[model samples]
Target: MVRIKRWLLAALVMSAGVSGFMLTKGTSHAATTDPQTFISTLKSPVTTVANQYKLYPSVMMAQAALESAWGTSTLTTTANNYFGIKGSYNGASVTMKTAEYDSNGQLYYTNANFRKYPSAKASMTDNAKLLRNGTSYNTSIYSGTWRENAATYADAANALTGTYATAPTYGSSLISIIKQYGLNTLLDASASDSSSSNSNSGSTPKPKPVVYSKATYYGASGTQTARLSGQYATYRLYNHVKGTRANITKTAWSKVAAGKNVLVYLDMRGVKKDASTGKKTTWYRIRFAKNTSAKKYWVYTKALTLPTVKYTSGTAAVKVNNTVSGSYYDHVFNSPYLAKSMGALNKLTAKSYVADKQAIKTQDGYKSTWYRIKVGKQAYWIAATETAAAPQYDAVTYSAASGTKKLSAKYSKYTLYNHVKKTHFNQKTYKWPAGSKKGTKVTVNFKGVKTAYKTTWYRIQFNGSQTNYWVDARALA
Candidate 1:
């Protein structure tokens, strides 16, 4: 009888070992298989949760990735708590001490309650259920892509404050993740977020034409012609890059076909090149008065395919007018560049001199106003309304000179209609160095308003120049 009992015990032990080995193998396979499998499995459940809450799947995925470490976290494995959710879960709970830091930079330890469940799937379902009922987890106002990278999702899983702080590069990181992992593909209708398929026909407005108000020509050699006409005539602007157009939209630039020239508008905005691929895009999004939605059109330089226009000092020119009409020959400005003395150009700093307002497509919009000028330079079509009389200056000297001593401070601020320069002061603050001879003529030229401040306090940028700051009229002695 004793021998029989020993044999039965050995058989039971062998069975236990085999079961352990099988469990380990199964776990290893589940961990190593494509993460997308897990993503797919959770899609339906995630979609159900999002639809009930009207949340974006991208946002939900971000939150999940941040809390659960893509289902690999210790909390998920041990407790089946994907969200690190703190609270009592029926009678099944765990009490633990965790460190926390306050905004004032003080750290303290606190014991809190955590929920324990049977599996990750169960944890996820319960988390959704709790979020639906919990007043604190109110998912209504909480929605946005987490990070641009998959690894960031892991870090985000640990975030206690539903949202990661507004750290620099948050948007870029999330966007990069979406692009790399094709997470946006999960946004398809069949995926977790059904709203992706909802068609709101009335909400979308009709597409509008992109208006270009000005154009300039770069000669082979060198000569800047300030254009007077043909700002929006659609003659041609060259593409800065070569690639297949992917996200091109109206006014948005796209790659031109190989060996073919593309004419794009020179909408004035800084261009951006993709960090990974060299594809380029424009920045202008100004809109016209008629079509309010026209503002959505963004102009870029990379969409066009043409001989690149080399803008040299003398070759770069501009023109301003009432409106952008049909395609016509560019009547380029031939007059010499204008220059202004300190007395004329000094105060012209407050106003913004736009080189091209045509990119905005607004009716009667003007191109950038001239802020740089040289003396004795003459240009045609100088808008009479835009020009301001040269500032009158009263000379100041230590010794009695034959000139008037009254300062120009009392006169109304004057501005230049065209680009002007200062042959004198460099810094915004110019004064007589101590112990110098009194005959040194110190004249303060009146540049126009610094900025357009409305209330009792005034803070203005230079209207025609680059200087923008606070200037006290009383301090202008």
Candidate 2:
């Protein structure tokens, strides 16, 4: 049976897994074992993630070191995926052919997806999340690794031997590394009292019991989602730190976006005074993917408020109607009449939602069609002109058929389409393959079935070109 954690995710120089462990770069073995440098470099980031996620810093740091080969592993260097966590982040991923044992316990080679992260800290945060959330099948499978649940980091380390990895020695390996580097030996550097800390080696205090914060900033002014109006880096606020700008790094989320959605974390907002200019910059903290991790980033207000919502809606039921991308709202609106949001859909994992109903709404003379999108247990609305009528495709396979077929003379050239997107593959240039001129025979392979139209599609090599352009039965007439 397939391991629940091994479910393919989005990756890297090294492929992660279809089973347990995938392929890596030219060097399968770890290139370096510099534990000191690795621990030093990752200490701050691991501490932050552990503190936020309620994981043991020592266990997490040890896992990172062992999995990423002390930060010299191919996957770590190329993809920053220290935990061998496979899956995409924000539609980003890398692929590699990995050697692994399938559920049948037979070794095989296959390409697998691993999540790509922006920073090492980001990967650490994601890894911590996996432990906290566990696999979809078992939410409490890794609960033994929680700082609250585990009496010590050693207990947490042992919990991963079979569950986190295929090796029986995985836990001992981590323990050795931790002991060698004195990773878990420290109570916590933050509690610096010379009297108690310097008193004795065996006398260090245990960590204070964790208190879940009940503070909700929402009741202040409430939250809203908005896209960055323009490209400007965000910074974190450190009230306890002496200097304003020096407290936190300036680049929180640097990727620029015009319509990129952000979950506004607070409505009261914040203002940071520039050291040089004395001008206070208004900042709004937000999460890029609201439904995923709860990690937050800050963005200046102007870049977000600049893009005005301009969407065209259509009437009649449509398949995978393009997601309602809103400029001002945090997500698709809950209703055309209300200003509430439904959260943003991730680009890679977001299957097109069906808009089954449409209504006309006029706000301050801005008239548009409001498409009601049904997702899961609830439905939401997006106001704009509708252009979602044509059918798209579902699961496709590459077996079954391959050969040549003659097109009908009715269409000298037919517009090529992206079967999955339900949009023209090429807007201007590609119509029918030049070799597929009216009634001409063209090479076809990889049969696909699109449901709504109940049609068949074939991957055709156009004009001896390698690109796999798609053509449905309509071209065959």
TM-score for all predictions? 0.29, 0.36
Residues 145-254 of candidate 2 have per-residue lDDT tens digits of 77665657777787775567646577798889778778775523332232255667746455443222121121121333444443433323222211232123232232
Q: Could you list the CA RMSD of all candidates, in the order they appear? A: 20.9, 23.6
Q: lDDT for every model?
A: 0.33, 0.54
- In candidate 1, how many clashes are counted? 53
Model 2 lDDT vs. the true structure?
Answer: 0.54
Give me the displacement of residue 46 in model 1, in angstroms: 2.2
Q: Give me the runs in candidate 1 sitting further than 4 Å from their true place.
A: 1-34, 102-111, 118-122, 125-175, 191-477
Candidate 1 lDDT score at position 37: 58
